[model samples]
Every structure is written in structure tokens, then in C-alpha cells.
Target: MNKRFALLLLVLLPLMACNKQETPAPAATPAAAENAAPAANEPVPADEPAASGETPAPAASAQTPAPEAAPADADAAAAAPPAASGALTPGTDYVEIPNGQPYLPLNGKVEVVEVFGYVCPACAQFQPLVNSWEKKLPANVRFTYVPAAFGGPWITYAKAYYASETLGLVERTHNDLFKAIHIDQTLKGERGQDSVADVAAFYGKYGVDPKQFASTMESFAVNAKLSKAKQWAIRSGLEGTPTIIVNGKYRVLGKTFPDMLRIADALIAQESARPAP
Candidate 1:
């Protein structure tokens, strides 16, 4: 394996040994695009929310009822002792996050969609690690990427994603997408900081049409998919990037990733045995 690949594996393997609680994050809005300069060097989001969607709020943000009328599951978990039981049952514990303004879920698939941007350095580091994890995914699982368009240069990278997926160049050229932007710094917001055609054309060398790709990047179809992805991320109670959601309800966040796959597996197994809705 190349040194970078090895380093990435080493970094991700330890994640299995730890798990992060899926704490709720602030509501996603275009105001917080990945590359947007924060006020006075403040922190920023690793992935930006898509333009045309609104994700569901997390459980922590759920409507609170009177203490006397507490929800059954909440009371049960709180009253039960930890040594004898676990917290929250699948399905009963959480609800589905709707896809924003657009796409709906594909039937009979366990989605593992990732929300990422080519220009984010943290996203660059996450690429190889998630790719390795994908290779070992179960037959019932499905994986997809939500290319975000929060900033001007970001939309260009988003176009590259659509073109690559359309032309079957994703697996071969995916990693390079990030490297070309972050490592080599070749992308300088082409077309006067508003157009992504130059980079989309670069993917065209691998057989993608820059114009058609641009249209799809802004298409209703892509918009719906982006919306759903945001919903999935939000319902998963994501605190940051690199979160994974199983089905529309069960989510893995924080130090979750591959390691949290174990808990995800447990939840999936249990859900599989339950009666269908």
C-alpha cells in the first residue's frame, strides 16, 4: 500500500475502539458553507449544507411535553438500569429525517451517504478511509456521496462529482478530485470565482461533458439527493463531518465511522427481525 493509504488506515482503525455520541449540531444553512471565512478566525464546518433542503431536527431538539406526560421510550430508558439493558430501541428510539426539497429514499437499501466537499482538507483525509470501508460493505448496503455547493469554488467541485458519477469515473478519479484541489492547489475558483466549468472540463478528459455536467449539478434530481443527504445528516445528530447513517433513523457519528459499524450492525440486525411498517 502507498504510505498515505497506510497512514489513513492506521488513523481510522483506532476509531473502531472508540465511539462518539451523536450530539445534535446547529441547524444547517447556506450561511455556513464549508469554506466561508468565519468571524475573526473562528471554526468552520467541514461540509456545507445543500442549497435546497431542510433536515429534521435531532431528538435533543424534539418538542418537550409535560413531565407527567413523558414519552414511553424516554421514560423507560431513563428508569431502566444500564447494567440490565441498553438505551433506545431501533425505530422506536428515532424517526426518519426527510430528504430536503427533493429526493426520496430508494426502497430496500441501507444508505451510507457521505456529505463532503473537495476543498475541505479534512474531507480529503476522510476519502481513502471511507473508500476502504466501502469495499467491505454488506450486500444490502448502499453508498452515495452528497457533493455540497455552499461556496463558489465548491459548486465546481460538485459539478465534477456529478460528471464523474455520470461517466463511471468516480472510483478511479474520486481521490484525485480532492488531491487536485487541496494538495496541488490547482483550483483557484476558475471563471472569476463563480464558475466550475474549468474543473468540470478536467473531469471531461475522463469522458464527462462540462456543459451537461453543469446542468445536472444544478438539476432538480441532484437537488433532491442533496436535500435527502442533509436530512440524513441532521437526523443522525451530526456534530460534524464523517457521519454515517443507516436506514433513515439509525445514525453513527463522531468517532463512529467504521468502528461504530459494530453498533450499526447490531441495530440493523435487530431492525431486520422486526415486523415491517
Candidate 2:
């Protein structure tokens, strides 16, 4: 009986040892449990959002429509593949003004100056387009018109513009003057034909006192504006009428009229990112 009991005890003890080897033991301490936890630290890509967090905002596109060469070039532009999104090329698309001229913004707003001439057929063509574009411009931008005073009858036109401004008749006669010269062809812009009297007479029809118009054209204030416009034109490095200067820093250049506005739009976007001067 003793021999049988000993044999059973040996077999049972061996089975208990095997069971203990198969089972897992609890961690000895809290620190050991933490050390056993899995961990990972991955970096987020610059162009991609993080793996676990609030979604990031969409990035601005880097590509823009290339400048159109001419009205007929529209088809060619449409056919070309889009250029990669990036900053605009300097000297090719736009030339930076040599000296960073201080901008005299109105009401603390960024200024966009249009150097145009009344006698310029191109300016006349750009008028309606710009007029519409300016209306839709953000309130933070101030659109200013500076009539080019290039020799010939343009000087007289510039004086006429300032006179209208002085007499508070510019808003009423601005488009009228353009129509009078372009469509109506009644207000001639000849070398000597469109005299100061003729220009003042044109404003007379707009309810401006002819005497006031004539005298205001020669006022010191009018002369100052004309002189300032001449300086602006020269400093802008304009080879033609209808040149646009943004914040007095960049001279916008584009192949088509619409492209000109597009370039301006891009420049405004860049300006919006800058800290206030």
C-alpha cells in the first residue's frame, strides 16, 4: 500500500509542475506594467495631416494660370498643361520697383494705383473691365486712378480729371468723359484741338460750373496732383498706359487684360499675408 501511494504522488507532482510552467504571472509592480506597454512616435509629413488629431486646413494651391499672350492666345493657354503652383517669377511676369517707395494708402488701406490716360485707346478698352474689377475688390484695398500726363493732349485730360475731382463732378462725369471721347467721339483728344476750354466745357454739361471747372484745373491742388501723377508714372517705369502698381512696390505685367487682373489678384493675396507696415 505504501509503494502505490508513493507512485501516485510522484505522477501528480510532475503534472502540477507542467501546469505552473504553462500559466503567465501578473507583473510584480505598476512601473513594470508601464514598461511593458507598447509605444510609437511618428513624425507628420509637411504636406500631410497628423495621424491622430483634429484635421488640418487645406493648403493654398501653388499653381496659377500662365499669362495669356493675346486675345487669340486664349485657345493656346487653354491647351497648355497647368504650371506647378509656386511664387510668381520676377522680371519675367513682373518687375520689382528699384526703391521700395513708401505707400500712401488711404484710410489705412492698401493702395492699388492705375496709371492711365484718357487719350489711350488701350486705356479706354481696359476701362469697363477695371471698373468692374475695382467694384469687387476687397474693402481693405483702395483703388486710385492717376491720369497719365504724357505730353500732347493727355496733360489737358489730366487737368480736366483733377478739375472734375475738385468740383465734385468726377463720379458723375468719369464714364461720361470716356464715352464722350471713345464712343461719342465728340470730345476730341487732338494735340491742340482739345483745349482746356473744350475740356472744361465737357464738364459743364455734367452740371459743373464752367468757370469753376476752368479755374480749378489751374489750381495749386490740381497742379500738385498732376505733378504727383507724373512722378508716379515715371517711378512706375511704365512704357505704356494702363499700368497697375500694387502698394507702390510691384508693377503688374500680364499678357492679356484679364491676366493683368489675375496677376494683381495674386499680388494682393501675397500682400494679405504680410504684417502691416
Candidate 3:
């Protein structure tokens, strides 16, 4: 029975996250191709080509569809489990980030940041779970979304995310954007060469002017946030999307989506228990 359980975990692990890789430019090098190899811990191959028009080596594909769930039912699916207890095994469940710090300045609250990209299908799959999970969080915990800028369509959506955020449209459009790309097919995923205008037109349905949305996507402020997000991903040593960082000190590495939240709950408890600085 134990062996069967372990084997089941192996099969499910690859489905829970998207591997991060650089989309090769036209003048790509052999060394660049070598760098695109899947990490030792990641077994899935890259099936979706990046929007750069050059196919990257096999890693996890970003085009996989998330399981279907009605929008209204997502919260019930994400209801928080009872508080986790006992010491969770390090390295196995999660790894500590050396010199890690919150994505934003500490504000007398525990910070939980999810590093995700709109173009990552794995992230889209994890969205419903996290959306509900976050809603039940205590007032003392702050949840922040840091978009991943992995180049190609990733940069496009990252820019769109920041622009929407600047215009205060993210709270209304976040999930719909995911549905548009992954389910509705109204928007394209990382595989498509989506431009700023394409993304802005989608936002137009929500009352924002398309031209205004497009301009905001390229604004200096949005560019700064995009740059900061890239740096945060680099400093976190992020190798995939849908990663959870608790208080910026631990990176959750659970084998399944629910398991990831379970681990994150435990870490949040641990951080909450620490004496105030």
C-alpha cells in the first residue's frame, strides 16, 4: 500500500506545476539549449512551444487545461482545512530560502506570496484552489500575487496584470482572464503571440478603454512592477510557476495542489507563532 501511494505521488507531481525556462531568441546558442533542460526534480517534458517562434527543449508544457469547476463552487473546493500541526519535514515538503524576505515591506502581518504567470496552465489550475484558500485567511496574514515574467507571451500577460492592477481591475478580472485563456479560448496561452493590444481588448469588456489599457501596459509604473517581479522570482530561486512562499522564508514544495496548501498552512502557523520583531 505504501509503495502504491508513493507511485501515485510521482504521477501527480508533474501535473501540479509548470517548469520555468528561457524562451530562446533567434540567435540562440547551444549553451542556451542546454540550460533549458528540465530540472532534475521535474520529470515532465515541455510540450508547448513558447511564443518566441523558437521551440524550447522539453520541460513542462504550459498548455495543459485545468480541471473544470463552476466559478461559484471554487470557494467550497478551497475551504481551509483545520490548522496543520507538528513539524513538517524540510527538503521533502519545502525548502528554506536563504536570506529570504517578503515581496513587500513587513507591515505587522505575515506575508504569503504566490509566484505565478497568467500564461502558465499549471498556475491556472492552481487558481481556484488558491482563490478560496486566500479568502479564508486571517486578517493578520497578507497575500500578494507576484506575476512571473518568463519572456514571450509571459511578458505580455505580466504587463497586462500590472496594468490591470494599476487601474484597479485585477480583482474583477483575474479569474476570468484565466478562464479566457484556459477554458473559454477567448485569449491565447503562452504558445500564442499575444500582444498588448490583444490583452487590452479583452479588458475592454470590463469597461476600461482598450487604448487606455494598452497604454497602461507599457507605462513606466507598470514596467517597474514587471521588473521588480522578475527580480523577486530570481531571488527566490524559482524554477516553476504556482510556487508558494510563506513569509518569504520557506518555499512550499508539496507533491499535490491540496498538499501544497496544507504545507503552506503549516508554515503560516509557524510564522504566526514567532515573537514579533
Each candidate's TM vs. the true structure? 0.55, 0.67, 0.72
Deviation (Å) of 240 in candidate 1: 3.1
- What TM-score does candidate 1 reach? 0.55
What tens-digit string does per-residue lDDT give for candidate 2 at 154-264? 778889988887778877888777777766777775313587888888888877778888899989999998877766565655555567788888887665456667778
Clashing pairs in 2: 62-85, 62-86, 63-85
Better of 2 and 3 by TM-score: 3
Best-to-worst order by lDDT is 3, 2, 1
lDDT of each: 0.49, 0.62, 0.72
Candidate structures ordered by TM-score, highest first:
3, 2, 1
Error of 2 at 151 (Å): 1.0
Pick out the ten consecutive residues of candidate 1 with the lowest summed lDDT: 13-22
Off by over 4 Å in 1: 1-106, 188-194, 215-239, 256-266, 273-277
Candidate 3: lDDT over CA atoms?
Answer: 0.72
Per-residue lDDT for 276 in model 2?
71
The 10 consecutive residues of candidate 2 with the worst lDDT sum are: 15-24
Cα lDDT, model 1, residue 87: 36
